[model samples]
Target chain A: MQDIYILFQVAGVGIIVAIIHTVLKQMGKEDIAHWATLIGFIIVLVIVIDYLSRLFNQIKSVFILQMIL
Target chain B: MGSILQLFVIIMVAAMLVIIVREQNESISFLLVLLLGIFVFLFVLNQVEQLFNLFQSIVSKFDVSLLHLDTMIKVIGVAYLTEFISQLLKDAQLNSVAVKVEIVGKLFILLLALPIFISVLETLMSFIPQ
Candidate 1:
């Protein structure tokens, strides 16, 4: 349940960022728009990295991959 | 099955979102696809565990050595992990790197199976008439 919510949060951030970027660029603020997109990507990436770590741990436990990790 | 249906719906929605984002930001679209791939794998992980457990139980009933069973499992795991990573790399446009990774995986699997190969050879050698 919680996982689904986090996914939605990331998706929402992406959509919002895309909107903000397009709006800013329309106003002739290309640099600001680029920064906004980059920040959005970083935020989503942070969340994704956390999820990926959890996934890796789960894989380690499931596969008993003591040596590889 | 119901959960699979739910996953399908989620994936469809995510695909739509990715398509929408493609025109705006290509990298973000790629990220979305990558995230969806991970999500799908996570969703099916429990099934994978169940399958492994079933295989273990079935193999235990046989007279095969535990070492062989363990090696078999490890080889399967390595193959799967390698395929997954290589596919991701290919999706990221790293074709040459993906090919190298696959070669590495094949070599690792071969190494893991060496003990089994030795056992087979010894058994065959013992069949010769003294």
Candidate 2:
């Protein structure tokens, strides 16, 4: 349920970051824009990594991976 | 019907958004696609679990070895995990890496099938003169 919102959240972050980058680029702050992009990427990564781990864990348990290992 | 329609709409909208934003930020668009992929998988997970439950019950009724069933299920899981990863790699323009991941996945499925393979070999060997 709550998981679905994560898609929109990532999308929002991406769009917002893009706007920020474009704005900074116009001001000739390429270095700051680069930093902003990196920070946005990290933020998205942080949000996604949590769900990815949980999904993998669920997959493992559902597949009875413990028995195989 | 309504839920399916809703899912379709959401997916369409999200895809369009990703396309529009892709020109702006590569990393973020990649993450957006990743999130969308995970969300859809999670959305259908309940139905898949139900199907597996039904499969387990039927297998139990037949007095079949649950170990083999477990291995088969795990192989399926490996396939799924690999596809998830390989697709992400491909999305990131790493086609060779994606292919390698797929190869590794096949190898893992083979490893998991070893016991079953041996069982078949033993059955065949028993049919020959000892």
Backbone atom clashes (below 3 Å) for every candidate: 0, 0
Scored against the native two-chain complex, candidate 2 gets a DockQ of 0.75
In the range B41-99, model 2's lDDT, one tens digit per residue, is 77667667888999999888887766687778888888888999999999999999999
Per-residue alpha-carbon lDDT of candidate 1 for residues B1-130, written as tens digits (9 for 90 to 100)? 7888999988888878777777777677667776877788788777888988887887788755566767777787788778878998898799999999999999988988899999999999999988
Per-residue lDDT tens digits of candidate 1, residues A13-69? 778898999899899999999999999998888878787777777677667666855
Docking quality (DockQ) for each candidate: 0.47, 0.75
Supply candidate 1's per-residue lDDT for A17.
Answer: 90
- C-alpha positional error of residue A57 in candidate 2 after TM-score superposition, expressed in Å: 1.1
**Predicted model 2 interface RMSD:** 1.2
For candidate 2, lDDT tens digit of each residue in A3-65? 676677788888899899899999999999999999999999999898888777777777777
TM-score of each: 0.84, 0.92
Task: Give the least accurate 10-residue stretch of model 1 chain B, judged by summed lDDT.
Answer: B63-72
User: What's the lDDT for all of these models?
Assistant: 0.80, 0.84
Residue A65 in model 1: lDDT = 69
